[model samples]
Every structure is written in C-alpha cells, then in structure tokens.
Target: MNMAISSTPTSFSKSLKPSLPKARVFNLLKTPPNSHLRYTLNLKPPPPRLLFRIGNPKSKSQFKSHHSPIRSLFTGIVEEIGKVKQLGSDDDGGFTMTIHAKTVLEDVNLGDSISINGTCLTVTHFDTQLFEFTVGLSPETLRKTSLIELQMGSLVNLERALKPSTRMGGHFVQGHVDGTGEIVSTEPEGDSLWVKVKTTPELLKYIVPKGFIAVDGTSLTVVKVFDEEECFNFMLVAYTQQNVVIPLKKVGQKVNLEVDILGKYVERLLNNGVVNAIK
Candidate 1:
C-alpha cells in the first residue's frame, strides 16, 4: 500500500518533471550573435547624394556644357568725371538722365557701355544714388552734341565699348557718335593737358601728327595736327586733366572724335598699293 501511493501524488510527481527547457520558441527565433538584429534584418536602403545646385537642373545640363552661349562684349574706362545729375522726362518724350558718377562705379553694369559726352549710352539703371541712362536725342543728336547743352551739373566724359579681343585700344571705337568738336584750347601742358580738338572738315584726312586720337572719348596722342581751312585741329597731350577737363573743355566746347579706323585701313592699303603701282 505504501508503494502504490508513491506512484501518483507528490503533485503528480512535480508536474511530469522536465521544466527548464521552456526557452525553445525556435530558440527565441535565433538572432543575437553580433546583434543589431542580424544587421537590421539584412538592410539595403542607402544611396543618393550627388548634389551640385546653382540654378540646379542637374547642374543645368552641366552648365550648358561649360558655357559658350556667346553674347559678351564690353569696354569701359573713364573712371570719374560725371555730372548731369538728373534730367528726367521719359515715357516717350525720351530722356531719363541721372549721372552723378565718380568713376561710374568702376565696372558698372545693367547693360554697360556709357560714353556720355561722346554720346553712345546704355546703362538704363544703376544704384549708389545715380546712373540711369537713356538717350533718344535726335534733333540731330540734339543739334550736334552738348547732350542738349547739358547743365544740371555738366562735366562729362565717359567711354565703354571695345571687346573684340580688346588690345586695339585707341581705335576701332564704334561707340559711334561720329562728329562734334570744338574745345580749341586747353594748354596747361606740364602735368599734362594740351588738348585742342576742333574736328570735322571731314575729320581732316584723318588728322595725324603722331596720330591716334579719340578726344572726348579719351585715347589721345596727336600732339599737333593743325590743318585749318575751316577745321581739324587736334593737339592733345594727356596725363590726366581729370582725364581731360578745362571746365570740361572750352573755347567753344564740344568734343568726341574717332578718326583711326586703322587709319582708314592704312589709307586703303596705301591707296591700293599705289593704284597697283600705277598699273
């Protein structure tokens, strides 16, 4: 009887004996080795950062394939000597002045090319309290230059236009103002400033004394040409009279000459090699 009782009770033999193996839920789904959940469940999502930006559109077709969309020709050098500080009246009577310049802001833009006293303008807008340009002057360039007799401030002389690979310097200036000259006197001549100018007896057989002249548009070096039967003076010296001033020049005042289209192509190839060496 005692043996029979042992076979059953004792909490049914401690609930069938084998307890500790309860941790096998497939070994708790097996991952733990160098853990990070087995490299985050075997990851695969990371590859995208080629950024370049600037007006971005994939670097705008590689910036339009290293740029050559052409359009680039500029020339400006008169640095300071600007006045006519306001001449309004636009919306079609055409005239929107405003130049109070001082070296025309050194590298001014907004459609560059200024050339005020010698005509050729463009600026159209600026800052630092002034720059605005626009000149529809025709009553024959407002009766042949003085920019309609300036005066609000006056003093002018600016230039900008010449990039065809530059270096031609004092010549090919197509800032195209053509005719207008008077300042027949300046004379100081030491710190330099001889000047004279006069022009238009048909630009007098292209002046020439030491040649190369531009006058109100600067580039001087004629030192003396004379030829008066009615006009073609020249003189010019240079070292800076505020880049050429004498009350912005007087003795009748007016300046802007450009003779030297390579001295009219070396005088038409020496008059066509002297008419082909007299045939």
Candidate 2:
C-alpha cells in the first residue's frame, strides 16, 4: 500500500499551505507506539494565517470547510443532516434501513456511497417523493458501528462520496468503521463542550492525541488520551455542537468511530510490508 502526499502552492494557503516533509511519510511507516508523527504543513507561508475568522456570525449549521476530495473520499465532514425513517431486521438476519435525506439525495443513484454515521453503505433503493434511500446492513456492520441503536426519527450525519474537484478539508475517511465507542462524560469548557469516549484496548491502540477520529460521522481531533481507561477526549466547538447530533446523545449512548485511515495503512505496511498486509 503506497501512500502519497501532494499539495499545490497555487491554491489558497489555507487549502495547501506550508508543506509536509518526505521523511514524515517514512516515519509513519516505522514509528512506534507513543511516538508522534511530526510533519510541517504550512497551508500558507512562514507567518501562519488563520483560515476563518474567530466569529463569522454565520449559522452554526453552515459547515465552514468545503474543500474535500472528489473521488469517493469522505473527509468525515458531514454534508447533510438525515433522519431515520425505518430500521428493522432483514429476512437474512441482517438489518435494513430507510433514511430520509435532503442534500445528499439530490443526485444520488442506486449504488452511491453514503456515509451514515461514518459507516459507508450502498444505496439499495430510494423514494423520490420523500427523499429517502434504503440500505442493507451486514451483521459485521452492526457489530462494528452504533447504527444498530438507531430508531425511527433518529437524526444522523450524512456525507456523499468525495468529488475529485473539491479541496480536502478534514481528512481522508474511508467510511470504514473500525469500532464503536460509548460517551463516558461531557464537560463544558467556556462555550465549547469536551466529550470523553471509552472504547476497547484493541481500538485504543490506534488512537493518538491530535490524531483524527470520526465520532458519529463528524471529523474531530483527539485532544487527550487515557490509555488505562481506554478513552479519549475531544472538544466540540459551538458550531459543531449546534450542527451535529452527537451532543444530543446521552452519556452511555454508543457512537460509531472511524480512526484515521492513514494510521491503519501505516500499521499494515509495517507489519506486512504491503501486499500481504492488505490481504
């Protein structure tokens, strides 16, 4: 599995400023646990610049970042707000779901990739009248994500596959849920909310402070990590809290978690070189 990092200076500095070192790529392939990956990304020049104003007065519902990949990539940026219309066990002992969506349904087709709480699902059927789509969930998907907890009228985050022309904002999210986690607690820090989530040791092995984690399909940065507790903390800005459904979840509620794809790739590369790792 070859990983490539590319940036163009011609674009806005906020989109692709500074630059990443070639060595950082190599380090990711060999770094040990507890060692952080270091790279200089100057989306702009020497004197760093803030991409957006601290208080733009825009609706919190407005997603500030629009630059994401175009080719079936999800930056963990929730592009639309969808609601659960139906959820039940299929005849095959699987799960079938109907979700009503607005934005993502505009140009959707029969087999489009739609990220539902960070777990990618293929559209099986759709109703143009209600702007709804149906998806089938394998037993494995239920085991790995919190989608099983969904009920009718449950609001979920939704994002369409990346378009190649968009600018990458969040990070590469394959919509492959690595595991599920539970919210341990939430504390208010000024206007922001800090959430603590607890998971398993096997899953914690891949999380790192400052690393990216998708909580219920929204991309967030891990602020603090507790190895002994098998938990991590992330801050939710006012805008995020207002826009996503995560804040509405109770302390013990389960949430889907997708760790950074880059980390998983690096781990596989180190253990099996490349060919065998993917297998």
Candidate 3:
C-alpha cells in the first residue's frame, strides 16, 4: 500500500527526474495504457524496510458497558414501584422503614434481602394480606445512602434479590449505594427524559462516560461525565420514564447512586500490585 508515487499517476516522464552520470542513465520507457508506471533504476537495490507495531486502533465498542458476573446480586432492574408506609426512628437510633409491595413479596422470607432504591436491606417482617414488608436501616446506611430522604407515601423503586433462574437484564448491582447525588437538571427530548446528577469527586472518580451507573436502583448507561463540574448524565427512554420513579424527581432532589462495582475491583487489584512491588 505504501507507494513512492501516488495511485493518481502523473506524467511518467515528467515525474522522473534522475541526475545520473554520463556512463549510466535511467531511460524513461514509453508508457502503457491503464497500467502503473514502474521505474527500473539500474542503481543499487534498496535496503530492507523495518517495521514496528505502535498500538491498536481505538475500538468502536467504546459505548458498550461491561457486565460483571456476580452470583447473588441485585441486577439494578426495578421489579415494581412501592410506597413508603412507615419511616420512623428505632430504639437503636437507626431507622425502621416499611414499604407496601406485591411482586417482591410473592416469594419473600424474613431474612431475604431486597433492594429499595438501590439500598440493600434484609426483610424483617412481611404480611401476605397487607402486601408489605419491613426493614431496618442501620446508621451506616443512612450516612452513605439517600434513604434518609424517604418519607411516608413516597414512591420507591423495589427489586428482589437475584436468583439462579432469574434473568440478568442489567449489570450487577450490589444494592449498596456508593453515595447520593443531587439532580442538577432535567430535560425532555421528545418522549425521552435526560437527567443530570452532580456528586462529589470521591464518587465521580469511578464514573465514566458510556459506563454503567445505577440511579435510584435503575441501571442506566452514563451518557457523559463532566469531571471538572462533578456531574454525570444519562437518558431515560419513554418506557423507562413510566417504569421508574426517577422521572418524577425534580431538580435539587437527591437520588441514590451505585457506581459500577467492576471499577472498584480493578482499582484494588492494581494498587495491591504497586505495594507488593515496592516491598
């Protein structure tokens, strides 16, 4: 593919300008129709060309989010919408929360873990008739998550724990919220909705454009991440607009955020190697 002259050939004689001694000369031969011109230089042959590989071309799959395989995890797929029936302080200085849901409670148990807006909690009690379940939120959960913003009659995204037979629709979510982000803005594009969230750099360090980020337990692809501004955004299609409670949230409100767990695992692995090498 590397040719001295371009494919668009110039006048063969005009292009060739070789200063030669009187004894030896490169005679410009007559041109052939529809054929590439070749120069038979009666000089020394050229040396062998050297080659070296630099790097691979940029991938077209940059927009694709990676999936992490986890055995018992929340897929970040909201199974149903639930209402906060109770939000009160417990004797342990923690919060006792209750939600009224049906789908997640169909096969629930006392010790079963359920994700409420991406915060994993163990079911302490359930009532088949009432179609509700109770969970206790520890002080650490309140400090790390947006669960403290819950109030009575508030709508929440609910999802049951993953099972072997369950379909993995979204990326692996531990239902452990990394932090809370304030809704900076929301825009409507036709039927879809674009939501922008601003968080601290502590959490933004793990977020990346085209990667996965769970907002309020709904798995969504990050459209863009503004590192300097400490904000990230994702779009919700028409279907998602109706399925989750995110669409109803207005600007300035906080939403629970769970960054992709894969990033954390990679960071730990690489940092450990550096420490070992130093030793």
Best by TM-score: 3
Q: Ten consecutive residues with minimal summed lDDT in candidate 3?
A: 47-56
**Candidate 3 lDDT by residue in tens digits, 1-279:** 111212211221111122222111122112223222233233232212100100113312211111212324888889999998866543222346678999999999877888888877877778989998888655445445656456667799999989989899999998877778878889999999999988888899999999999999999999999988899999999988898999987676668888998899888978889657767
RMSD of 3: 29.2
Model 3 has a clash total of 0
After superposing candidate 1 on the true structure, give the runs of residues whose Cα lies further than 4 Å from its correct spot.
1-113, 119-153, 157-172, 175-203, 207-254, 260-263, 266-268, 271-279
lDDT tens digits by residue: candidate 1, 12-33: 1121112212122112223335
List TM-score per model, in order.
0.27, 0.70, 0.72
Measured on C-alpha atoms, candidate 1 has an lDDT of 0.47
lDDT of 2: 0.67
Ranking of models by lDDT: 3, 2, 1
lDDT winner, 1 or 2: 2
Q: Which one wins on lDDT?
A: 3
lDDT by candidate, in order shown: 0.47, 0.67, 0.68
- The TM-score that candidate 1 achieves is 0.27
**Model 3 score (lDDT):** 0.68
